[model samples]
Each structure stands twice: as C-alpha cells, then as structure tokens.
Target: MIDSVKTPRSTYRQEQADATRVRIADAAQRLFARDGYSATAMEGIAREAGVGTRTVYAVFGAKREILSVICERWLERAGARELAREVLDTVDPVERLRRSAGWLTTLYSTDFDVARVLDAAVDEDAETRELLAAKLRGRNRVMDQMISSVEPELSVPLAEAQSMFRAFAAVGVYGALVVDAGWTPARFESWLADALVHQLMSASAVPDPAHP
Candidate 1:
C-alpha cells in the first residue's frame, strides 16, 4: 500500500524558498523606501540581501512586485481592519465612530513605510497599481463590516453606515498624503490625529432620529 504520510522534501523546500524570498523582499523594501522606485536597481536589492540578481527577479518578477509586497507587509503590521473592528465592538456608537476615524489616522500617521509604499504605488507600474486597488477594495470591505457592527448601537441606516465607511477611508488616504506635504513627521501626525478626531466627532453628533 502506498504511504499515507506525505514526503517532507516538498514542505522543507517550500519553507526554505519562502525564507529566501522574504529576505529578498525585505531588502527591496528598505532600498525602495530610502531611494524612490525609479532609483532602486535590482542589483542593489540583491547586494543588500546577499542574493543574486536572478534570485531577486525570480522571487518578485520586477521592482513593482517588490513594492506591492512591501505595501502588503506595511498594512498587515498596522492591524488596520482589526483596529477599526475593535472600535465598532463598543456599545457607544459615538465612541465607536470616533475610535474608527482615529484608528485610521493614527495608522497612516504612525506607519511611515506604509505611506511611502502607497504613495509609490499610485501611478506606478500596472501590477503595483492593480495590487494597490485590490488592497483598497479589501480595506473598504473591512470598513463596511465595522460600520455594520456599529449600526445596532445607533439610529442609522445601513446606507449611512456605508457612507461613514467611505468618509473614513477618504480621511485615511488624505492623512497619508499629508505626510508628504512638507510637514515634519511629528507635526503631521499630531495635526492628522486632531483633524480626524474632529471629523469623527462631528459625524457622530449628527442626530439620527431613527435611533432605536
């Protein structure tokens, strides 16, 4: 009878490859973040990772793919959607909305690489652009889910919840862009946090007569 257990060779090789790919991408991220995408060459990434140029290309295909990987990493590090969800779990609808907006602004202001990679992704390579779009769509879905969670605590329609979702998204992206607008990192972060908090408070104060 054939053995039921799988061979370890495939699993071991896959794990090894994943480690190598991660190293390459990490190097690419650092290089791309320091030097704009246009200036970061494949050879530089290989040198940084102590890998061959062929290996870098084999792992990421091109510079744009590397950028996408970095962006994905940045988003994951932020615990972004989960943060928004946490706010929605609160019983107070106003607090929930305030926390949601604050969460986004804080995330964007705090994570430098995320802002950098996202800025680079815009109007960049086709692959990177598509990947960024997919990320945004996924993030928007997360926002909508959070909105639905808060609706029970407020007198708002599901449509209004979705509106809040879009509004927060715009605020977050705008916050990210502001980081590049010549403000010191600390100043930008503080101003963004305040701006988003004010917006959230204003939104939450809206009288929804339909309050259950």
Candidate 2:
C-alpha cells in the first residue's frame, strides 16, 4: 500500500493564515476609519493587529492594497453582487428598479463609514482616487445592466435611463437624506422606490401626476 500523508496540517496552516488576514484587515479598517487613510500607517496597523510591520507589508504590500481589501470586504459583507443577481433575475421593470434602490440603500447604510473614509481619501491620495474611479465605473456598469434588464418597458432613451438611475442611486443622496437629514432607513427606501419608479417608468406605468 502506498503511504498516505495527512493534509490536516496544511489545512490548519491555511486557516491560521486566513485568520491572520482577517485580524490585519479589521485592524486596518479601524485605523483607516478613525485616522483617515493617509494618517493610518502600516506600522500603526501592524501594532493594532499585534503583528510585525513586515508581516502587514508581506500580506498586503501597501496601504492602498489594504484599503482595497477593506472596500472589497465591505462589498461582500453588503451582498452587493448577490443583490445585483437578484435584480437581474427580476422580470418587472419597476421591481428591478426598486431592488436596485434597495441594494444601494443596504450598501450605503451598512458601509457608510467606509464610503466616507474612501471619499475623504480620494482628495488626498491619487491611488485612492483611482480606486474610487474604478468603484464608480463598477457602479455604472451595474446600473447599465439593471437598465438593460428593463429596457423593453422604458419609453426614455437608454442614455437618459442610465443617467437617471445613476443619479437616484448615488451614495451621496442616501447619505444626505438618511445620514445627515435624520431619515430612517425604511423611509429612505420608501422614498427611493417611489422616486425611481416615478423617474424611470414610462408615463403609462407611473401613477397619475395630479394625485401627489
């Protein structure tokens, strides 16, 4: 019989590495949120994570990579891709728009701090600005996909539909109405659903304008 080698040791090592990555990411997120991206150094992140500075660098390479990981983590935690799948699967145009709004609401509400941190960092860091641009492009792509799903029902031009979708789904709009204006999440969602339906749907699909 051939000698069988155990793989548990390797599995355990991989688990340990994953745990270390989570710890470092958590520490970096805290520092970045509290201190701003530029102010939070790798040394500080390593200290917060209880690891050596070289270890942080070895894992992430640079602070920008750490921030990118944080953004990706936030997106995963917010179920962004899953929500997009759900939106794509829905057949009704109005429902698709509502789901899209819901996705944005969930994302902004759950990761508002990360968004704020990224927004602030963009002005001061070129790397972060590029990251933000990539994120925005991703956002626009999602919007385009969503708009295409309901294109058959829309009366407006595709370009106009996409622009309106992007405007209504903006994070800043949610931040303003919910974060700064003190509106509840449910209220924001309700308003967003109503606004999107009104703005994107054809006149035949929309509620009577005189009814308020």
Candidate 3:
C-alpha cells in the first residue's frame, strides 16, 4: 500500500491572512497621510484595500492601533542617517558639524509625513504622548552620535555630550513649530541652519581637556 502525504490547509490559510493584514495596514497608512488620522475610518481603509470592514477591525482592533503602526514606520524612515555616518567618517570636525546640523534640518522639515502626523497624532490621542516620548529617545541617540563627531574639540568631558545633544533637539523642536505651524519654510530652514551650526561650533569650539 502507498501512503499519501498531505499539505495542511491551515498553513495556507494563515499565510493568506498575514498578507491581508499587511495590505490593510498599507492602505490605512496612505489614507492617514492624505487625510489626518481622525478622518480616515476603517471602512475607508477596507474600501481602499478591497477588504471587508470586519477584516480591518479583526486585524487592527481599532483606528488608534493603525495610526500607531503608521507613525512607527514614518519615524524609522525619517531618522535613518547611515549616509551621514559614512560621509562624516572622512570629514573634519567643521564639515561634520555642518553635515550633522544640516541633516537635523532635513529630519525636522516638512519633507516627511512624520513631521505632520506627529502634531496631529499628539493632539488627538493622549496615549500618543508616550509614543512621542519614545521617539524622542531615538532622536536623542542620533543627536549623541552627531555630538561625538565634534567631541575632539569639546572643552568638557565626553559625558557633556548630553547637553550638546539637547541643544540639537531644541533646534528640531523650534524647526517643526516654525515650519509646520505655517511659518515660511525657506526662512525657517535658513534660520535653523545658521542657529544649529553656531551652537555646534560654540559647544565644540574649545579643545577637549580630557583629550589633552
């Protein structure tokens, strides 16, 4: 007698369900970016993705969960600074400071949807205040690396990098308020570029006592 081997039906169904969840999330992201999160509904996402409304609720539970997923994706892309790391590797302190400050301006500028969603999300959901705090930790880590780029010229101990990082974060906060709050984009970028460059140069101007 020959024995028959069979593939599991549940395995195929699980893969299909996972694909459907991804599609729903992508559709919701596009809508949320176009229309603010409050305006985008589960039915809209279902229609956009060609799935049933039940599918969206089944996968995401609520609209807030979907918004959180989209915001997470947006921040990941906006703060990606690996290119800055490579170029800064060969550059001197002056050039590295310029590049680092310029990169911050880019990150805070309206070029990315995260900048817009950030304000809107916080206003709508109190829970997202914590989400923003978590994202702040990530931004601080990036700023710390930028500070390290200029550490050779810093007058204080390496631990003082935290202050320099905070100054950079202030630049970002002001940049977002000025530009995203309807201030002139050109003037905001120009002013921020000049201010951040000055701050970094001043903070790292003196030679590190620790180094000497």
> TM-score for every candidate vs. truth?
0.65, 0.86, 0.60
Q: Model 2 over residues 1-212: C-alpha lDDT tens digits?
A: 99898779889899998889889999998988899988888999999999999999999898888888888999999999998999889876778878887887888888788888776776656776788789879878987988878777677888898898888776678779988999998889889888877777787765575985
Candidate 1 per-residue lDDT over residues 91-115, each given as its tens digit: 7665666566666665665666656
Q: In candidate 2, how many Å is residue 191 off?
A: 0.8
Which candidate ranks first by TM-score, i.e. highest?
A: 2
lDDT of 3 by residue, 1-212 (tens): 88897768998899898889778878987787799877888899999999999989988898777766766665556555664565368467755655665666556652455555555666555665776667667777767777676777755555565575476456446555664576664555566555545554554463465895
Off by over 4 Å in 1: 1-12, 140-212
Cα lDDT over the full model 2: 0.84
* Candidates arranged by lDDT, highest first: 2, 1, 3
Using TM-score as the measure, what is the rank order of every candidate, best first?
2, 1, 3
Q: Which is the winner by lDDT between candidate 2 and candidate 3?
A: 2
Model 3 TM-score on a 0 to 1 scale: 0.60
List the global CA lDDT of all models.
0.68, 0.84, 0.67
Using TM-score as the measure, name the better of candidate 2 and candidate 3: 2
RMSD of each: 6.8, 3.6, 7.0
